[model samples]
Target: MSKTITLLGSTGSIGTQSLDVIRAQGYRVHGLAANSRVEMLAQQVQEFQPDWVAVVDEAAADKMESLLAGMPSPPRLLRGPEGLIELARHPVDAVLNAVVGIAGLGATLAAIESHNDVALANKESLVTGGHLVTEAVRRNGVHLLPVDSEHSAIFQCLQDAHSAKTLTKILLTASGGPFFGMKREQLAGKTRADALKHPNWNMGAKITIDSASLMNKGLELIEAVWLFGLPPEKIQIVVQRQSIIHSMVQFSDNSVLAQLGVPDMRIPIQYALTWPERVPGPAPELDFTTLKQLTFDVADEETFRCLAACKKAIAKGGLAPCAANGANEEAVRLFLEDKIGFLDIGRLVEAVVDSESFGGTYTLPDVYECDRMARSFVLAHI
Candidate 1:
């Protein structure tokens, strides 16, 4: 049976690779959405023939409509964030949210609220609104499958394991980005181009910058807490330069299970879509004969303040994580635009996290408010 899915962020790195998986596995793409990439979205619509499509940028939606006008059987077109939520509510077995940052949070909640399982790639969804998302997952009885490589590896390792009680620690692995092993002085003069060069994975500009600053790993740390119901203390990040060992989990009996594979997003993307029933896709198989070495080291939190800041926010609870995410998002944006230096990203995020008050039970509106407030603070400071 072909599983129907609604894919958000259909033009991104994960989204395009997911389309490749869909084509290979014969999954039905019922709807697709993108931020402002109408050209690519049009190509996707033509190829996949979805029931509906959404463009979050209103002007781009107009352009998309114009581009699709020639099609004899044009699918329904929706505009803006409401369109994304509407697309999420559409009847489907699952919703794959690959949208970057907090913009994807609402669609994630909408999908779960509609009783649809979610394949989550957007870390901010959990980092900023974990309480709400986890509650919805429990209330709606839906699976919130992880699409990120590290989380997917951990998820796979935990299958049929000795339960959460037996799990002692999660060894989260980082590629260390392109700036691994560099000191604060070494990174001060780094350019945006230098930071964008990820040693392992091909990702978007925002994520690449986050990876450079180790903020992506930091955000993932907070995300892991909600996804696995673990405390920040139990999760330890290991700087794995090879990028082969995605992540590992240690049991109370001192047994450690790890997931190893080639650096490929399609592997996890396919896993999240097919789940519990693995099917081979286009990703290359690992050849042990040619493999050389896999190395690991502890991450230096002093050098990368983002990781420390993330720990602080996770410990404080409430809206601190949301504030960190918002500030980081803005900081990354500023860095990408050459408005701020590479080191300034972490400094700005830490400042915002420190300034925000913590410890409170929050609603969905509070989450968004915190996000807005953080961004406002970053903008004012910058």
Candidate 2:
């Protein structure tokens, strides 16, 4: 029996790889959505023949509509964020949210409210609105599966219900990005191409830049908190250059279990889609025979100010993390466009985190307002 799935961010790095898994498994795609990338979205609609498609950008929606003019039975087209929300509520077997940034938060909540299981690739969804998402999941009795490599590794290790009770800490691993051992001075003049050259993974430009700054890891730390009910301090970031050991968990008796795999997004993506029931699919088995020694190093929060800022934000609770994330997103966007220097990314994010006492119980409106304020702060400061 094939499962019906709705895929958001259908033209991104993770989104494209997710399609590979969906195709291999013969699952039905009920709906597909993307912010732009009209040509790619058109190609996907042609291949998958989905029941509905959404283009968040109206101009791109027109392009998508023009591209799909003569299909045998083209899917219904939905436009803008409401289109994304409506497409997410299609009640599929699973909603794979690969949408990037804070934009994915509403769609994630919509999917859960519609009583659909979510395989979350969008870390910002939890980073910005973890409380609301978890509440919706608990209220509706749905599973909120993690799809990020590090969180997925932690999730896989925690599957043993007996030993899981004794879990003490999450040894979250990091690839250390392209600028691992460099000091702040060395990164001051790096370009977008320099940042996008991830040592182990091929990702979208935004995430590639985030990986360069270690902000991606910072966001993951926050996401891990919401997903595993662990504090930010309980999660330790280890720089594993090989990108092999996805992550590890420690038990009370000083025992540790780690999940190891090749650096492939599809592995975690496929796992999220068919969780609790492992199936042989697109990703290949890791070959340890040719594998070299795995190395580990301590993360320097002093050097990666973004990581340090995230610790403070999550500790203060409430809208702080949302603000931190918003600031980083804007800072990264500016850095990518060469409007700001590389080191300025960290400087801007930390300043925004320190600008206010962002502590309070927040509603959805509060989250968006904090996000807006953070972005404005970054814009004003930069």
Candidate 3:
């Protein structure tokens, strides 16, 4: 069936892949939102011709206005963070939230409050505000679909209610990034360029750096805890050298089901959009005949302190994951700008987490306050 959707972060890696899915599925776009990529955003608006468009950056919004002046029937334009929030509240069949960071948390909540089923690519939404988002999902009776490959794999395996009832634990697989085997001493001199060279996936700079530091996997771990109602210990991180075997679920009877495919984001994006109803997608099938091997190794959390800190934070519960996420986002930003060393990324995140007592029930305002506190701590200490 044809569906209407709103795409947040329309110019991002996940956003663009989502557009590809929309194009293939003939899904109609209700709205499109982005931060500052006006040129790309303009092209998207022209193609999709959404009823509403939002630009988070002021200058970019001005540029977008001028660009839209020539359109015979340009969609309504909403500007700044408020505009993004408003765009999320506009009811659509599905809201594909691909917004990159913690900024996505608010929009995710807005969409849910509006009773829109959210196809969430923004892991930070759950990482920083899992309780709030999950509660909203439960209250609003909207589906919270996972767009991350590992989570999608786990989601797919849990499709059968009969088997899902006996589910015991999840084996979350990781590509191990570029510096998988490197020790702390070996990582000291790694540069931003070195960290960005992910061996398995093509992702944005911030995420790429997070992957190298194993912080991406850490954030995903926190996200899974919320999505699946599983403890951190139950979701074991296995280093699957090959990008295939995205993730697996182990049942109480010792049976296991795994989702394997080529490392294309489109497969999960498409599934999230057209869930419980499979359709032919642009992504290719896995060539198992030519496959060499699918090997596993234990994640060296001692060497990758970010992953360790995340496990600790989730176990601590409440707003601890929020602080951890805020710190990692800030640290990754500094690392990208060459203001901090690669190892320092983990050091800063772990330190910020250690310095705070992040507990208690949180409101939307509380989430923002904790995020600011964590970011401020990063700046003060750095």
Candidate 3 per-residue C-alpha lDDT over 174-221 given as tens digits, one digit per residue, 9 for 90 to 100: 999999999999999999999989888888888899889889899999
1-382 per-residue lDDT for model 1 (tens digits): 5899999999999999999999999988899999999999999999999999999999999999998898878899999999999999887988999999999999999999999999999989999999999999999999999999999999999987555568889999999999889899999999999998998899999999988889999999999999998899999999999899999999988899999999999999999999889987999999999898888888887888888889999999999999999999988888889998888888888998888577888998998899889989988987
Itemize residue pairs with steric clashes in candidate 1: none
Model 1 weakest 10-residue run by lDDT: 159-168
Give the clashing pairs for model 3.
none
lDDT of 2: 0.93
Give the TM-score of each candidate.
0.99, 0.99, 0.99
lDDT of 2 by residue, 1-382 (tens): 5899999999999999999999999999999999989888888998999999999999888888888887779999999999999999889999999999999999999999999999999999999998999899999999999999999999999999998889999999999999999988888789998999999998999999988889999999999999998788889999999999999999999899999999999999999999888998888789999897999998877888999999888898888999999999999989988899888898989998899998878899999999999999999998
Could you tell me the TM-score of candidate 2?
0.99
Q: Which window of ten consecutive residues has the lowest lDDT sum in model 3? A: 352-361
Q: Measured by C-alpha RMSD in angstroms, how accurate is candidate 3?
A: 0.8
